[model samples]
Target: MTSDTPARRRARVFSRRRSAPSRARRRLGAAVRMIAALALAGGVYTAFTPGAFAEDNVQLSAAAQEGKALFDNSCISCHGRDGQGVEERGPSLIGVGSASVEFQVSTGRMPMTRQEAQAEQKTPQFDETQTKQLAQYIQELGGGPELPEGELVEDLKTNPDALARGGELFRINCTSCHGFGGGGGALSSGKFAPSLHDATQEQIYAAMLTGPQNMPVFGDNQLTPDEKREIITYITVQLQDDRDPGGLFNLGRYGPSTEGMAIFLVGIVLLVFTSLWIAGKS
Candidate 1:
């Protein structure tokens, strides 16, 4: 074997040095690829995050924003910041829908005095426009059934059978608490059925749809929209605006009890007159 020389050793050292750099280069390339994969994974996770999904879903309209301001001012105390409501103080406004808000606020039945069996109607805290704004806010918080725009009652002027149909519906469904004349009546508790005299078509329709207070929900499944409007026409046009036809006394329109009283009084009066006339003639 040839004796080792500085030149040969130096050549071997040079080869080793070159090979070291190549190995380092391969390690660096692997590190770079690993870092790039991590970054891509992070980006994909963020794109699919729940927070991102929520942000996309939270878009609100201008009317809803205006109503939000009003809700924050007046309704936040009981309803909470997001209208989820305060336990024992108020119920959730989210998912209650605009129809519920309109029925309660428009009819002056909300911002209640105290929790009871039912809420009573008073002068509304907000006017018509403000009430609608509040409804908009509540509607956007969590979606639910909405009132149909435009006239609540369909045109029934030409329908001769509309009044009769309405009266029949009212008697079958409404006469239990509301009297036959639409006068208010007492309920099981201190609560009472309110008079329909002052109720507008919108209020009536909203009440039926939302079932405000102790009232039961009469959804579209229970009463079709046409049937609801028919019921309203009967309440507003026929019952509220009845006339004394045939020139007979209506006797307060309380039906058989009032009629029996009137008959009894007239019979007594006639008998007394006849007896007095016979005595004088004899």
Candidate 2:
């Protein structure tokens, strides 16, 4: 009986030893599950955070809404509640695009004090932020040609053949109104093509895209991005910033028209002087 008891105790010990690894594995698995639950809870909390969700949803459409408000307050009289325009107050802006709004507002040619033949550039009623908001409103209201986004000036400087290509394109297309040197020239009525002297790259690009006032719209189809950049390079670098290298005169950068007028006047004066000299000698 004593020997049998010892054998039973040995058997019991062996069974416990065999089950120890299984118990340890179960404990480890439970710990892993608890850790996974904690991580999942944390992820859920972060995703539902008020600030994060608000920032994601609210800011995305804020600009356009604010722009709509601005349009309602100041522009409703001229542009109408639906942006359809009111007779002589304003023209329809259904498809004018954000470029037109930005150019007109940023340049302060809008929110006119009085209706005239043309809107003149003046001190802006709204700052740049407000102007952009207005542009966003106009953009959302109606779809039209959009100015290319991002840094337009940087690309013009980097392009190697910009100057050459721009010169040719400018002479062919721009000389009639802008002059050969971008000095600007007369148009019908009191309207005139503005000079490119002080115009920034953005303004120039906007002008081309929107065709403010009587200027014809040169959309992306008419002038591709590369062509527009080339034209801007020529206008800014060669025409606006030219030092007129060598001893030759620039003649106001007006090309042959002004030179021809000056030559004709000079010739007339010389002929009169020669006639007097001949009479005196005779």
Best by lDDT: 1
Q: Global lDDT for candidate 2?
A: 0.79
Query: How far out, in Å, is residue 261 in model 2?
Result: 4.2
Candidate 2, 1-282: lDDT as tens digits: 456688899999999999999999999999999999999999999986532221213332578788878888899899886577789788877778888888888888889989998888888899889988888766766666677788775766666587789889889888888877787888998888887777777778888888887788777898888888888888888777773422246677766666678889999999999999999999
lDDT of 1 by residue, 1-282 (tens): 898999999999999999999999999999999999999999999876532221324667888888888888888898887787799999777677899999898888888878888888999998888888899877877766688899766587447688778779888888787778777688887888887878888888888888876678889998888888889998888766663312256655555566778889999999999999999999
TM-score of each: 0.70, 0.68
RMSD of each: 13.7, 17.7
Clashing pairs in 2: none
